[model samples]
Target: MIWDAVIQPFADFGFMRRALLGCVAISLGATPVGVFLMLRRMSLTGDAMAHAILPGAAVGYLVAGLSLGAMTIGGMIAGMAVALLSGFVTRATALREDASLAAFYLISLALGVLIVSTRGSNVDLMHVLFGTVLALDDAALILLCSLASLSVVTLALLFRPLVLECADPQLLRSVSGLSAVTHFVFLALVVISLVGSFQALGTLMAVGIMILPAAAARFWATGIGGLLIAAVAVAILASLSGLLLSYHYSLPSGPAIILVAGLAYGVSLVFGPAGGLVARALPRRHLEA
Candidate 1:
């Protein structure tokens, strides 16, 4: 009976199957990037970059009226531009990366809302902001899977440089020319992951899937490999649970998935073994004298 409750919806419904597949693809690609973002102390940067994608996607909606290719391309362009500009401002001016990114994303958010409000109904705006995971078409699913595959391969190739850059950026710069290249490539991966997922999770919530599971994983593991595995595991679990909840309760699917991830984060914060509240509060076994 329990298995039927968990498994029947997907078996009976094609849309449920597609939504689950898309969410899985996003978790595979985005969670690892989120782990790196956390390691680099740039977790908020992922949120800012997610907002930066909105204006471009809105413009694409204006021009093409929800064409997947146009919106995806536009989001990629906007996200990359904001990332590069923020880096340039940090290097060229006195402003820090966070401040510059915040400014640009705020502006981008306002512009996006304005554009969408003028051309589309409130429902359309809601769709853009919150996404319709249950309604994913074949094209969107293909894009999600393809981007996930690309992200995995590229992250594997860049792993060493990324770790070096996170640990000792100056040493990485001194030792090899890969420092800047790796940084930019990693940003590209972020953009790709965000853009591909926006079709399902929307701009406002896409970064949640990226950041929350990774944050939860931090409390469970110390090493990069462990973090990656843990984060992906949490994300996949959240996706499945959230989809089932949405199916049974008529909840919004995107937010349901994100909320499940958030719940995992909360659980890890309190109960995880590494640095969770319970672990810290518990008396440590006295080290053998």
Candidate 2:
């Protein structure tokens, strides 16, 4: 009965409700990961981890025949495997993170594509690159929620140590008992979050939202807590707005949300109050002496 006209899009139906909830969950869990990813200069690698989830999903679908539990387990394994490989290569050789990331994803993607083609489930390709949000069922919702909750806990407990390592790896290294090992483990968790969320936002756009909002937040804030708040707030608003726009216009939700986030990034670039273009260009703020 024109519920959207009266209420928010989030209340239009179970589908919209779950979609919004999923996005909100991701916003809370992934935004902080974005902050630390940026701090590590590994900002652009989230997409690879997302795409790296494809082969796992494919294997999951084939072996368990569309069971969400199996697919999640499979995808988690695949993501961890990729993260492990990247960590191993970086630790062993002179090759940098970018090179290792490229190698891992390219190979994993090729394998996934081949497997999916052989299984005659080409539609899964779309799910791999961009997930079907309207199709999510109760089980998937539960899984997403659980993962989000667990991630929040991990982030809370490890917040300080992770930051210390990100900001000053060498200094942290000198202290005995604390290894770069802990930092590597944390990055694996980040990859797991990306994989778990691949169904809602896809690999490409997931990284965009994950990294962009946090980046925009960093233009002004001095405190990590404040910056996290700014990023999470912006992410939630952008996600909900983007979802409503897409539903009304019959557009793809993933790209729509990412676009809104990209727009925020553009605005921040031009006018975000500190180091942004407009912030730098116009007259400085005048204060009474």
Candidate 3:
């Protein structure tokens, strides 16, 4: 009976199966990126970049009228621009990267909203904001698979440099001239992950899949390897639970998925084995003893 209730929707509907596959693919690609973001102390930067991609996507929607190819290209362009520009501004001027990123993302968001309003209706705007996960096509599936492959491969190649850069930027610079390349490549991966995930989770909520799972994992794991593994596992579990909840209760799939991630995050906060409230509190209790 439990199996039937939990497994019936996906078994009966092709859309449910596709949604699960898409979410799983996104989690695989995005969760590891999220780990690096967390380790780098740039979680909000990921959120800002997600917004920065909106203008390009909105412009694409305006020009191509819902063509996936156009929107994906536009979003990638805008996301990369914001990332590079923010990094450039920080290096070139006295301003901090976070401040510059905030300014750019705000402008980009306003531009996207204005463009979307001028060309499309509220329904169209909602689609851009919330996504159409249940309506994914073959093209979207192929794009998701391609992005997952690209992220996994690139991250593998850049792992050493990226870790060194994160752990000691000055040391990495002294030993290798590829620090800048590593930074840019990492930013590029962030852009790719965001743009690739936009179709399933939308620009607004896409970072949830990336950052939330990673945050939850941080409470449970000590090393980078463990953190990455835990994050991907948590994300896949959340995706499955969220999809099932959405199917049985008629909830919005994207938010449902995020909510599941959020729930996992909540549990981790209280009960995780590493840095959780319970774990931290235990140390205090021992000290008092």
Better of 2 and 3 by TM-score: 3
lDDT of 2 by residue, 1-289 (tens): 5565435666647888888888888888887788778777778777677778778878987898867787778777887888888878988999988899789988988888898889846666667678766667888878878887887888898887788787777777887445566666677768767765777886556777688888888776768887888888888988887888888899999888888888888888888876888777896779999
The list of candidate 1 runs beyond 4 A from truth reads none
Residue 179 alpha-carbon offset, candidate 3, angstroms: 1.1
List TM-score per model, in order: 0.98, 0.92, 0.97
lDDT of all the models against the reference?
0.92, 0.78, 0.92
State the lDDT at 276 in candidate 1. Answer: 98
Best model number under TM-score: 1
**Model 2 lDDT, full chain set:** 0.78
Lowest summed lDDT window (length 10), candidate 3: 280-289
- Prediction 2 TM-score vs. true: 0.92
